[model samples]
Target: MTSDLRLSRFEYGFAQFMSVMASAPAKLEEKPKERTHQTRDRSREPHSRSMPFRNEMGSEMVDIYVGPEEEPFRVHKQKLCRRIPYFDKMFNGQFKEASENVGRLPEDDPAAFDVLME
Candidate 1:
């Protein structure tokens, strides 16, 4: 009688454990439903414009010139001023280069500037 009672209890516990294990996989596999109010139209949004500055000469308004005499890069002042802190200070602050609109970087490599421009 005692053995039968213990066996019944063990069987009941095993059945409950197996039921939970079976349902866990189903719950994990189910995909979450998307919210109805979260519809967004990404295609209608306006794309950004291309860079106005280029490597070519006389293409656009050249605000500042950089690098050595042999290999100089013509870059936009507004773009540089906005992007680089060093350039912003030099161009905006009361300096000789601010008025001249020409910044010479003899020590700095021109290839680096080319990469930056690109």
Candidate 2:
């Protein structure tokens, strides 16, 4: 039983990857492969109208464009801002998006934005 309880490193790694993939945002209807590949790493990249961020749960969290620490990055809220062409009408306000989620209100919602700051 104890032997069975342990998983090999490969198995562990595979499981971790699967979990990450499952959580990471994914496209619903497939698109041209080029576009799909380009936006894969949405978190740690520079700002672009093209970039989008979702968590390990296949939901849109934020549209991020990573930069430097001082000009560190630009994080955009979705509901107020425009959604990507393909992904529009998919998620509700602040749903299936960034890990930094908040209430179903506009980005300028004082309480919701406050939560995001923390």
Candidate 3:
């Protein structure tokens, strides 16, 4: 007949072939495959943990000083010591003394100074 009629006939046959293929099952689905990994306890040392300090008492001071070149960061140390709970109370007296002795470590007592404006 015409080209449009031939195309419609081919489309009907293609559609029927797809429907039959979808109804058929593959032979691989009936076979059991081997697992590469073994089933182990996923809860131990990973998912669950028990911290000693989390249950018991914690330390008085936590020294976590990390600098650019391993040099002791005086500013961070001063800030960190202020948050030590009991140590913050000594801010007016002992903390002030400690702040005075910060950069004056035996060699630079006169480091705390302003330039002359003459």
Candidate 4:
């Protein structure tokens, strides 16, 4: 037989073998394993939540001076970013405010900023 004919026969045999293997049923183990430890009730367990305002003291804070009065306010950078996209960009983006950790808003009302921070 020629090399091409031999190769074709081998390929046909391989394909048939693969098809048979693919069609075979999967076998399960005869024995089952037991749990090593007891499962505890997770609902009763104490868990820490994202209480940003309550836990702000531990995190990094940013100083913001707003309005013509330049009324100063301090806020947690992370919590501020989470609620305000403008602050997020200003504090995270390649701006002077980001590096300084300080923001000045001469045009914005301090009362409005206070409401937002609260």
lDDT of 3 by residue, 54-83 (tens): 333333322222223332323333333333
Q: Per-prediction count of colliding residue pairs? A: 0, 12, 0, 0
Model 1 lDDT per residue over 40-111, tens place = 676765553222233322243334443465476677776665555566666666888788777766644454
lDDT by candidate, in order shown: 0.55, 0.36, 0.33, 0.67
Candidate 2 residue-wise lDDT, 15-110, digit = tens:
543353343333322353553445365577566644343321233344432222222222334432342321232233334543343323221233
Record all residue pairs in model 4 with backbone atoms less than 3 Å apart, i.e. clashing: none
Off by more than 4 A, model 2: 1-3, 26-118
CA error at residue 46 for candidate 3, angstroms: 5.3
Cα lDDT of model 2 overall?
0.36
Candidate 4, 30-87: lDDT as tens digits: 2446759988677765556445545764488899998899999998898876655566
Which is the leading candidate under lDDT? 4
For lDDT, candidate 2 versus 3, the one ahead is 2
Model 1 CA deviation exceeding 4 Å by range: 1-70
